[model samples]
Structures are given as structure tokens and as C-alpha cells.
Target chain A: MDIVCDKRAGGTLLQVNGRMDAVYAPAFEKECLLVIDGGEIKVVVDLTGLEYISSAGLRSILVSAKKAKVKGCSIQFCGVSGMVEEVFKISGLFTLFSIVPTVEEAFAA
Target chain B: MMKPQGIAFRLASLTLLVSTIILAIIVGYNYSVSRKIIVALAEDRGTLLAKSTAKKISTAFMTVQKVIDSVAFSLEDDRLTEKRVNELGQRVLINNPEIFGSAIAFEPFSFQHDNQYYAPYHYRLDGGPIVFARLGSDDYQYFYMDWYQLPRELERPIWTEPYFDKGGGYELMTTYTVPFYRNRDGQKVLQGVVTADISISWVQKLISSLSSREAEYVFLLSRYGTFIAHPNANLVMNETVFTAAESLEYPQLREVGRRMVAGETGVVELNDLPMTGDSFLYFSPLPDQHWSVGFVCSKKEMLAEVSRLNREVATLGGLGFVALALLITFLAKRITHPLRELTVSANDMASGNLEARLPEATTKDEVGELTHSFQAMRESIKNYIENLTETTAAKERIESELRIAHDIQMGILPKLFPAFPEHREFDIYASIEPAKEVGGDLYDFFFVDENNFCFLVGDVSGKGVPAAFFMAVTKTLLKVVAESRLEPGEILAKVNDDLAEDNKSCMFVTLFLAIIDIRTGVVRYASAGHNPPLLLPKNKDAEWIPPLNELVAGIMEGTQYTTKSMTMHPGDTLFIYTDGVTEAMDKMNNLYSEDQLMVVTNQCLGKSAEQLVDSVDKSLKKFTGGAEQSDDITMLAMQYLGKGSKQEGDDRWI
Candidate 1:
């Protein structure tokens, strides 16, 4: 998983590609916290390149989202496709997070 | 050849040949017996039918000829007159079984033998010989030059060409004439001609039926080759003579005719007649005539015997060939079973399954020898792997022990940050990760007095237990001097004196010791030939403070070390580290240089002492990126956050 922050939108864009499973979740969480603790809020996580997200990956995202909320930030997701999109929909996180179809839409919002 | 496939092929060949020969014998014997029985049965029926037909025809011919002879004797030798001759001809025609009619012809009477002379036989209107000696004036002139007189001049028995009788419209009649002669005087006097005006329809029907029914043909030829008995008698009498030798298509039949004309009778092949693949030819001479009869049948009928034999032999041969194949395959498998086992074992060995052993064999063959070699190989491999595993375990144990030793050596150093927690004037941090099980690098920091904080970082020569022990001792003795009343330079000098006195191993430590006055941020540091610690000036680039002496620890005891003072302004940072810190490796094996450390210190130049340390640690990690550290690394940092910004609760940053 790769994360790039755009300060203009006050959002961190996480462009994850390939499998985000149990082994990669911790490192992903640590990196997410690094950006969160930097005091940026209104985070938009771009999942356009993310091919898969398992339960562990989802849990890590929720934890990071909670941590961002504690720091007075909101994490919006965008460009969810493939199994990752289905997972988000099934978990009802599609309704929970501000999910948009593209990164541009999320950034605009 | 000794090759097993060769033996198999040879055995198969031998078995096939033997079975074929046996099959041939059985089939030939059966066919010969069957063919003999069939041929004998056919020949018996054919011969019986042919001979019986010939006898019946001959008996009828003789009886008819005898009746005609009796009529001729009555007309010529009995001196019968024309009326008597006519009556006798009528009686012959009526009494004979086969003669259709009999008649006589003689010269007109010239008053022979006192007016009692013989006359020719006469026939009535119905074509019977009428044996009358005279003709009535109105009886159709029976004695007026008979037609048989003309044919009588011919030397041979003349069969007059058939002529139609007007009285019997479309009825064909022909006369067979014979001359009557008197004996005893040898006179050439012709008494009269005896003739028979026989109806030829019976002979015509017989010949027509004979040739017209099937492929069989019969035609009579005179001695001069004239056709006599024929289906169309008039055609034979009118047309050219029938000759079998006139054809090119029947050269063999011509040979048969030649032989018949030469009086030789037997059989010969008829190369013509559109004979099939093979055919049988039979020829026989008719008795008392130059004519011969030829018969031909397809030879397929004759060779059916051989064809049946061949078919049976082929079937039996196929069965025998199948048996031979099975036997060869079975025998080959039996011969190669042991070799196949050996091959399997060999393959197993090649695939690294060395535990696979050939099965025990009692046969004293090359395969058994191979089994022995395989067993040996298996045993050797097992022993070698066992030894390898033991060696690997031992090496692991040694490695873990070395790791423990390394930790214990680190435990000997001052590793904690803020060594004097209550001293706010000086913020101190140090860290170490050894390069190996143990090394001689050491760093120490403690408060020497209420106003002075003391710390030393050093690297010893060589490594492992000897260097680590010397590090421990030197660290202890440095503390002893610092606890006494010595400055940083004097403490290192005293420790050097004590360390060099017993330095038999000739090892040394490059050290930089410092004392900081907490109330003023003035740090007085001394170095013994080590990399200078970093100092960041207020609003300036960080620089390394030059060491004051050339002596390393554990060298000559009298070596003098000098001291340099750096007065830290408020909000200025100071960083110090051993050479291991600057010399630490990154992923590419590039050193984390002093310039990089200087940048680290200056980047946090205005931050508190703790932030300076944190920045350096972060930079080190970013530069390392999972590269194995190569030396014992230690760094000490301090900063003056200044008195005005030092809030009561946040004074921890000072």
C-alpha cells in the first residue's frame, strides 16, 4: 500500500495496489497514523488502484479512520473497485464513509 | 545378440515359423482329402452320363442301318421287280425302329435274266420306301432318272444335300446311297444304287439342341472336312467346312485339333474361350471318326481346393502369430523384471530419494550387483545428511550464544536517554546496537556534579571478548575519575594512565568526553583522537568540534588531552556521537557520514535536545532502510530551549 498526501484538499490519498492482507496491515496502519498524527483532517483515501482488501485490511482502515476521527478528521474513500468495493458495500462502510466514484469527486467534496 | 529384445524377436520368429508350418500341414492334409472326395464324385457322375448317352445313340444307329440294308438286299440280290421293291421298302419303313424311309435305284430294265430283273425301291407319297418293281403309268414316274444317280457317281458314301419335298412342304429329305455289287467274277458291274430318303429332322433337332442349349457345340465333319451332322445342315452343306484350327484366339484349341487330326487324343489347355483365372480343358476322340469333342471349365473350380487351404492356413497363422506375440511379451517381461526394479531404484536415487533401496535379490547377475551399489549409495547419503544436520544445529547454537553475548555487552554500556532525569540544563540521549556478538565500542554519560554532566563515547581496537572486557574496565575507571574532582580532559587522562599500565593486549579506545554546565549551557568537551561531536551555533551551520588530543584510550598513560568549550546559546542544539554512528551502513552499504549527522543536528538546531535526538534517529532509519548495522552505534544530543520559553510544565524540553 502506498499513501500520498495532498495538502490542498486536506486529504491523504492512499493508492493501494494488489493484496492488502494481514501481513501488510500493521505497516499500513503505522503509515496511516504517521499521516494522521500530522494534524491533517478531511482525509480522502483513493482506492482506484487497490485490487483487493481482506478483513484485516478493512480492520486496519477502520482503526486508522477512528484514530483520524479522534484527531478531528474525517476519512472519505473514493474509487473502490473489484472485491474491495464489494467488501465495502457488504460491510455497509459504503454508507458509513463518504464514498465517491473518483478521486476528483472526493477531492472536490 | 545378447540383447534381450533380440532374444524376444528370435523367439517370436521361431514360434511363428513353427506354428505356420504345423498349420500348413494340417490345412493341406484336410484340403487334399476333401478335394479328392469332391473330384471323384464329379468325375463319376460325368463319365456315367456321357457313356450311357453314347451307347443309346449307337444302338439306334445300328438298328436303322440294318433295316436299310435289308431293304437294299431285297431290291438288288433278291431279284425283286419294281413292284416287289416298292412293297419291300414300305415294309422296311414300317418295321424298322429308327429308319424314316428306305428306297432303291437302278438303271432302267433292259430285260435282264429272261425278263425277271431287279428294280430300284420306290417310295410312296408319304416318303416310305415302297419296294415296287414297276411304276404305273400314273404313279408319278418312279423310274425316271432318280436323283440319287447323280450322287452315286461319287466314290464316298454320298449324303445328298437336303432338299425340300414339294409333297411334304418344308420337310427336308436326304438320301444315303449304297451300291449293290455281285461277287465271284470280279466284274465292275454296278447292279443298282441303294438309297435312303431319310427325314433329317431328328438328327437336326439333336444337333440343334446339343449346341444351342449352353456353351456346348457339336458339328459333324466329313473326312474331307465337310460338315455333316450340324444344327443347320443346309448351312454346313452350302458354306465352308467347319474347322477349329482357323482361329487365332484358340491357339491351344488349334493344338488340340492338330493332335486330333494326328490321331492323338488327350487333354490340353484352351487358351481362348475367355477362360477365367484358371480353367480345365478336356478333349476326347469320337470312335471311328476324325472328330473330337473339347470341354472347358473355369480353373477356379479346380483350384478351389488350394484356395480353401490357403484361407484356412491364413486364419490359423493369424492365431499362432497372436500367441507368439503374447509369449514374447511375457518372456521379455520375465527376463527384464529385475532390471526394471534396478532402474526404478536408480531413478529414485537420481530424484534425490536416496532412501530408496533395491529389493533383495538372490540371482547372481549384474542386476544384483547393481542392487549392492544402490544400497551402498543409500547408506552413504544417509550418513552424510545426518552429519550435515548435526553441524547445522551446532552452528545455530553458537550463533544464538553470540547474540546473547552481544546483548550482555550492550547491557554494560549507558544506553538509557536522560541519564540524569532531574537535570534540566542538559538533555542527554544515547543509543547503541552492536555490530556482532560483542564489540569494544562504549558510551557513558552521568552527572559528575550538580553543575557538570559528564558523558564519554569511545571505540576500542579489535573486537569480541578481549575488547569488550577492556571496554568494561575502562568504563569503570572513567567513572571513578569523573566521580573524583577531575574535569572531562583530566578524567580521561587519569583513566588512560590506569588503562595503559596493564594494556598487554596493546588495544585502544578513541573517546570524546564532555562536561556540561547545566545552568549556562557551556559544554567543555575533550577528545582522544575520535570523531568530533557536532555543535550547532545559533542561526549557523553545525560543525564538528575538533578533538584536543591525539591519544586514544589504553595507550600511553602520560598522554595529555586538551579541552574545548562551546557556549550554547539559548535554543541552540548540540549533538555528539561515536564514529559508529557516522559510519553506520545503509542498504547500499554507503556510510551515514559526518556531513549527514551535521545536517541532522542543524535541522533540529532550534528544537529541544530530545527533538534533536529524535530527528537524527528518524533520519538514520530513513537512510538505513533495513540494512544490517555494521558497528556499535551511539549518539548523544542536548539542546538549550532557553529560560524564557521553558514553561513550568514544558521544562522537560530543556
Candidate 2:
């Protein structure tokens, strides 16, 4: 799995690729933690390449969101597609966090 | 003693045997070559001597034949009478002293030779000469009356028999005669014959010298096979032939002799001998004499060299035997010395001294390398044994220390069950069993006020003394916070701060604490990442009542704890436990899962607090088989019956 990150306009953009199962979840959590700790107030995770998501992967995402909240950083997820979108809707994570279709929409949020 | 030494001995022995066999073969060949050389030399010398004798004899025969031919030619023509013939004879005698006398005879009394030409002389039988006119009662027996008549019959010059000569009158003499024709008709015509009367002493002397050398016999034979001069004088002038040639055993030699008579000169063996040894004869035919000379020498004498060779081979064989013996002894010692040392070293190593090392020599041969390998193996084994001993001792020591820690951990739990035997506000029971040397599960309950009882069950993560230490700290902090007159939520908040203040290694604990008002059966509870406790209603079914709160207690500093309140009805029981109780596993790896735990807890819904704990414990054992508990299984059960006097049969609840 690949997580490409770029910073623009004082916000972090993370592009995640590949399935986020139990094996890739830990890396995703570490990436999100690094961004939050950098004092980035607004961060975006692009899940356009995400094909599938397991419960453990969702839990890592939620944990990262809570960690960001504690640090007073706002996290937004964009480009959610495939099974990752369905998992978010079923887990009620979409109600808890902002979701956008593109990176521009995430930055606006 | 060792395999290499044994092989070396066999190899050395084999080498010795091979060398000995080769030496024997060489000795045999040398013997054969020397014998051939000696035989060749003997044959060459024999042939050379025989040829020298033939050359000398030929020269002597030429001189003698020449002298005889000159005398015969001188007498060939006779122009005078008997008086001149006698004068010629005397002259011949004076000129050639080697000739005894020369005489001439004429048939019909017409001869002139010697002194008794036509005289009527009588031959003397004893020693005297007699006048022919005074012969004893015989009237003038003339020359025709003598043995000379025998020559006239044959008509050839011949050597007459030895007789007492009246003319010479001293020694026995034989007459050599030659007959000739007086006319041109080429017939004898009764011409006078010339006679030479020679002494036999010279022929005897020649035969004696030739026979004196080493089994050699010289003999002369006439052209008609008559023995003239021989080693046996009696056989001289006798008509004799080689009788052995007629024997069947000499058929090959007979054939050879026939060819020899036809003038072949080579080698032939005389096989027909009456007790005569093996002989090799070399024959040379004399050209003028019409006779042959043969040298008969024994074959043993010609090949005496082979005997000398036998003696030389004996000497060489003796030397070879001595050399072989010395080499075998020396080789045995040289080969076995190293082997003996190796044998002793092997014996020492077999006796279980891993430290025992074979001595290595400085050479780079196989034996030296073997010694180095053995020493290296010994050294490695010693090091391995030492390391194994230390590791085993260290493991035992650690296990013993862990056992002590486990005992200390168990001692910390409240071993005195049924702490209040007389109080009847609620019936309560609790148990804690650590999984390892130490565990993080802890249970505590104390009366916060006259009406309120503060009870809690918490499990810290991980195992060992660290978790044990953390559980102790958390339990102590909970007690301190409970005495501060705070509610369940506030008490948890205070404890969390105290535990997380100096926390390293990210250690945390999951806790469920509740404060109950036994008078009203009202309880307030808070959770910190802990599974919810099960509550059994008095008339309804027992179920899990989950509390809503974020993970508190060491997860983050200043993390708040929240509480949920519930009013208890009569005979209702509350069960609180660490996850160890639900997460326990069997040998099949199936868990005492939470779903199973809930079903079991609801089975005895209306049971008292102690009955509820007992039923759950029994169910956990049945579900887990005989598999050991994998964690600290700690539980606290409490019940609140309605605050009133009960019936007589309900006394067991008090």
C-alpha cells in the first residue's frame, strides 16, 4: 500500500492506495498520526485507490480521527470509492466525519 | 594396532616379497647368462686348440711326404749295377741321417739297393745275420723267398710287418716300399721295388705325447681301414674299423661318419660307447694320408663352467636373504611408532575427557592433519558443554525467581473469602488468579459511606511483574480517590491521572467501577475501555448493560470518565469481571468468549450473588476443558435485595 502525502496552503493531503486491511491499517494509522502531530489543522486522506476495508482498518481510521481531534486538528476524508465507501456508510463513520468526493472539496470542508 | 599401521605392515611385507621374487628372477637370469658365456669360451678354446693341432700336423705331414718323394725320384732311374746301388744307398744314408736305410730291389735278380742286393742272405730270427750259402739246412733262400713276396701279390708299396732286420740287425723295423713300372706300358713288369726300413721308436714317441693330454687318444689308420700307429701298439698294422658304428644307438653318428668318410668335417657325438662318457668328436681328414684325425673330448669337461655359476648364485642368494630380513625389521619399526601413539591417544579420548586433546606434529602429512582435527573437535566439545551448563543454570534460576514472584502476587489477593460473614446488606464474592508469575487483574470493594459500597474490577494490559506493579498502583489510587467523597466517575478520573502521570511503555488498564446505595439499591458505574458488567433484574432476564465513555485510564492525560446510573430491584445481582474471565481459551483454541459468558450468566438469572459467581466459574471450567487459564481471572459479584425483613426461607441470602 502506498500513502503519498503533500502539503499545500498549510494543509496536509494524503493519497492512500491499495486495500486497507489489518496489515495496512497500522501504516495508515502511523501516517495519520504523523500528520496530526505536525500541527496541521486541516488534513485530507484521499481514498481513491482503496479497494476494500476491514473492521480493524476502520477502527484505525477512527482512532486517528480521535487523535487528531484531541490535538485540535480537523481531519477530512476524500475520494472514498469501492468497498471503502460502503464500509464507511455501514459503520456510521460517515456521520461522524466529513467526507468529500475530491481533494478540493476536502479542502473546502 | 591401528588400520594404517596394519596396512603398512602388509604393504611392506608385500614389497619385500615382490623384491625377493624379483631378486630370485635376476639371480636366475644372471646364472643363465654366465653359464652361456662360460660354455661359449670353453667351446671357442677347444676349437682353437683343435685347429692349432691340425695346422701343426699338416705341416709335419708335408715335410715328411716331401722327403719321401725326393728319395723315390732319385731312385726312379737306374743306369748302373748293384755296386752303384750300394754306393747310392750309403750316400743317401750319409746325407739324411733321419732315414735309417734305403734299399732297391729288382725282380729276377736284377736289383741294386742297400748292401744285400742279390746276395743269398738269410733273415735272422734271433739277432745274427747269416750268409745265404750257409743257411741252416736251406740252400740260399733268396730275397724272393722272404715276406717280400706278399707285396708282389698286391703289386703295391706297403708297410711290412715289423721283424728282426738282418741288414740293420739292431731294432725291430718295418719296410716302407713303392713298386714302379720299368717300361712305358704303364704296368709293373716286375720292376725292382724301393724299400725304407724305419725304426718304430719314433712312432711310439708321437703316439705317447698325443694321448697324454686329458682323455685324448691318437691313432693312425691305413686307407684300407688298417690300424698302423695306435696308442695300443698291439693293434698297429691291424685291419680294424670302428665297430661302434654298427650299433643301433649310433645310427645318427653312423650316418655322420659315412658323410665324414665322404669328406665332411664338422661335429658329431659318439653315442655308442661301452661305459664311455658323452664325447664330442671333431674330425679333420688328412689330404695326403687318406685318413682322418678326430679329437674326442668329454662334454662335461667342455661345460665345467656351469658348476662355477652354481656357486656364485648361492652366494648372491645368501646376501639377498640378509638384506630382506634387515629391511623388514626396520620398516616395521618406522611404520608402527606413529600408530602406537595414536592408539594410546584414542584410548584416552574414549574415556570421556572432552578436554583431552591429541598431540599434533608439525608435518603436513595425513597423520598430522588427523591429530589437528581431533584436537579441534575436543576443544569445540568442551566449549559447547560449558555453554550448555551455564545456560541451563541461568534458566533454572530465572524460573525459581518467577515462582517467588507468583507467590507474592497471589498473596496480594484477598485470600480470606466471605470477608463479612454477619453483614446482610449484600452477599459478595471475589477471586483473582494470575496467569503467569504476576498478573494485572485486581478486585476491591469498600464501604464509601453508611449507605454506599464502592466496588471495582480492573485489568491492566500485559503480564509479569510490571503489570503486577501497575495493578497495585491502580488499586491503591482507587482506594485513595474513593475516600475523597467523589462519585464513581470522579474517582476513576482521579485514579487515571495518578496512574498515567509517570507511565512509560504505554501501559494501561481497563476498569469498571461502581458505587452502590444499598438502602435504595441504586448504583452509579463508570467504564474505562472495560467490557460492560451484567445486571440481573429481579423479575426480568439478566443482560449486559454497556456504559458509554471514551477509553480513559492511562490512554491520554486528563481523559474524562463518565458514569451511567441504574436503579436495582429486589434480588437483583451485578457481576463485574476482567476480560480474563471471558477470554480464557481451551486446548482447541476456542475461547470462553463473551457471548458464551452472557448465556451462562443468564442461565442462573435469579440466583444470589455467590450462586452467580459459582455458576459462571463452573461454566468457564466446562467450556475451557482442562486447559489452564491464560490470564488473571478476577471477578466481583454483588447483590441488592429490597431493604426489608424477608421470609423465613430466605435467610441464606443474609
TM-score, every prediction: 0.50, 0.48
For model 1, the docking class works out as incorrect
List model 2 lDDT by residue over A49-95, tens digit each.
87655444665676787788889998999998755765465333565
Q: State the iRMSD of every prediction, in order shown.
A: 26.9, 7.7
Q: How far does residue A96 in candidate 1 sit from its true spot (Å)?
A: 73
Model 1, B1-654: lDDT tens per residue? 335455555666677778777777877787777767755654453334333333444444545656666655554464555466566666765675345555555544532544323343444444443333332123334334334455446533455545554422224655566656544376555556666665656554544444322124444443344444544445454432334345334555455555544544444444435424344444344443343333344445655766777687778778877887788768766666777777788898889887776778766777677778778878988898899999999999988887887877778777666565654444566666565677777888777877777777877654567667888888888888888968777877788888879654456677788787767778787776566677777678887675443556565668777777878776566676765677566876576877788777766755666667668878988888878765566676666544344464264433
* Best prediction by DockQ: 2
In the predicted model 2, the residue pairs found to clash are B104-B113, B105-B192, B120-B132, B227-B237
Backbone N/Cα/C clashes per model: 22, 4
lDDT of all predictions = 0.62, 0.66
